[model samples]
Target: MKELSTLCYIEKDGKYLMLHRTVKGNDVNRDKWIGVGGHFEKNESPEECLLREVKEETGYTLTSWQYRGIVTFVYGEDTIEYMFLFTADGFEGTQISCDEGELEWVEKAAIYDLNLWEGDKIFLRLLEENHPFFSLKLVYDTDDVLQYAALDGKRLWL
Candidate 1:
């Protein structure tokens, strides 16, 4: 199993900064909207991973970020990846498109309309509720169905 880290940057206008993935593939989540982030390279901290990813993906510099949650995906017999999720309210630079997809500012109220992982929506809702900082561990099965979820470090409604 390998672990990955990602950052979810929220803009100051109460909108979420997201990436619209246009990659065509068999992955069910492809061609969908996702957070601006990716897997971390060697020796990269979660913050470093996020800053680099945001810069690479949209040319923005993020700040005042806080760890929010972790999600795990299990595929088939032996595939697993842990995703570290973070949130931020401050950033610099204008948005730019990347090879991954187009960058968009999704309104806070309409985020549910976009195509996103079911478990991700849950965490997104948590972020909107202003949980401050916390960690969520979500387990998924081979079929990409959620199995369980647990949290630590803060109290959340979900």
Candidate 2:
């Protein structure tokens, strides 16, 4: 299992900083507007991963962030990714476009308009509600359909 982590940076104005990626490789979330982050290196914690990834991709030094949720990524027969999701509200420095994609500040009210994965949509909504969500384990079947999901051992917010 490959452990991956990501961070969602929210500005004081209720706008979220996101990355627009192109589908030129085998990345599962390629060609999507998603958070800026990557896999964790050895001996690095989730916080370290988010801070480093944000700085590397957007040239920002992150400060305030909260652990929002976790997701299990199932890709084909030989790949499984354990992902940790985080939300940040403060950072320093200017944003810059990275080789991964362009960077943009998206309003909180308009996040649903972007091309996001179904799982992302769910937790993004949860984050907006200011609720405390511990974890969400989603299972994607062979056909890529989210056949089952156990959220905090109960049904997720409907």
Candidate 3:
């Protein structure tokens, strides 16, 4: 089955709001630190999904955000996901406790030290570089190991 989702990295000062995916027992991202987002609701546009998810997950309404890229995740032979990526620098509201996991502002440089999917590292680099909007495809084995990566149809060695 194919799924559509949105992910947002909210930046403040020199840190990014991150979620530690430890509360969900069956989560695909269990124990990993990742950006905020979730699956798209019926008929929701990317921006709509981004705004709703940001609010639902982080309790912040995004006032300024950039549509960063589209990421296609191929998981073995069973599932495919198109994830719309975003980054936000402006928001309003008091942060609330998330039911999904603990939320914290992590130093951008220290994000790499956390447990993350290998393909995430690649896209994180792209985000850091302030690259133009692009498309990325990440293929993973059944074990969730990143096996191949491509950006805009061009194969990436890493």
Candidate 4:
């Protein structure tokens, strides 16, 4: 199945809101740290999905956000997910508990210390470097090991 989704990194004081995926069973992202977002609802645009997902996951209304990139995830050949990536510098609302996992504001510099998808490290670095809107393709084996990577159509060293 080709799934469409959105993921956002909301920033405040050098920290980004992160979700530790520990709550769900049989979750591909179990025990991994990731940004907030989810699959698109019926006829929802990327922006629309982003806004709704952020509110649902963090209880925050985004005041300002930028589309960062598109990540094409090839999970074991058949499970492909095109994830719309975003970075938000402005938002307003109180945080809430997420049923998907525990939420925490993690320092950007310390993020690498956490357990993360290998492909995520690449895109996160791009986000940290303020790279322009680009496309990243990450192919992973059934075991979730990153097998290949590309940026803007060019293959990257794994």
Candidate 5:
């Protein structure tokens, strides 16, 4: 199966908004900390998907954001997800309860301490460093352990 999605890290005061995936029982990301965003609806552009997903999940309309990267996630042999990654610095709205999980503004450095997927650590670090727009591919086994990783067409680990 193949999927297209958007994910964004909204930043303010040296922190990023993060979601703790604790609400869904069958979620692939259960107990994991991740950014806000979701799959694209038919007829939606990446920007439209980003805006809609972020608004739905976080109750904030992004006023300023950057297309940071693209992450191709390969889960074993059957499932692949192409994710549009974004970073937003400006937004306005009152926060609300998210049905998907609890939302928290975590310190940038502290995010590394969260329960995140290994591949997420890689891309999160790239975002923190303000790296140039990139393409990252991450492959994982059934156990969810990262098996391979590449950055911008250069193999980094395996």
Candidate 6:
């Protein structure tokens, strides 16, 4: 079944809020560090999902954010996910512990040191480059290795 999700990189100072997905036993992101997000709930738009997820996971109400892009992930053969990507620089609230895993404010320059998916690196670069709103498609093999990638309908070299 196709899935819809939202991901947000909440920025503060020179760091981004990162989630270490180690709590879920069967999580596809287990042991990997990623931005805050989750699968969409019924009837939730991208913005709604983003807001709800950020609050539930971080106890923050976003006051300023930008829609960064859309990512289409083709996982092996059975699962396809459309994820809305966002970046937020303004929010209000105190931090809270997440049941999903550890949350940390990772320095931008050190984000590469974290265990992350290859496909994630691709999009992270796009975010770093401050690319305009884009559409990225990432195709992965059964082993979770990136096999193909395209940006805005054009194939990317890596």
lDDT score, residue 2, model 6?
A: 98
The number of clashing residue pairs in each candidate reads 0, 0, 0, 0, 0, 0
- Give RMSD to native, each candidate: 3.0, 2.1, 0.6, 0.6, 0.7, 0.7
Structural similarity to truth (TM-score) of each candidate = 0.83, 0.88, 0.99, 0.99, 0.98, 0.98
- For candidate 2, the lDDT comes to 0.77
- Backbone clash pairs for candidate 4 read none
Report residue 29 deviation for candidate 6 (angstroms). Answer: 0.3
Please report, as a residue range, the 10-residue window in candidate 1 with the lowest summed lDDT.
Answer: 149-158
| Model 1's TM-score against the true structure | 0.83
Report the candidate with higher lDDT, 3 versus 4: 4
lDDT of 6 by residue, 1-158 (tens): 79999999999998999999989999889999999989899999999999999999999999999999999999987999999999999999999998889999999999999999998898999999999999999999988889999999999997
Please estimate how well model 3 matches the true structure, expressed as its whole-model Cα lDDT. Answer: 0.95
> What lDDT does model 4 reach?
0.96
Full candidate order by lDDT, most accurate first: 4, 5, 3, 6, 2, 1
Error of 6 at 131 (Å): 0.3
| Model 6 TM-score relative to the real fold | 0.98
Which sections of candidate 1 miss by over 4 Å?
24-28, 152-158
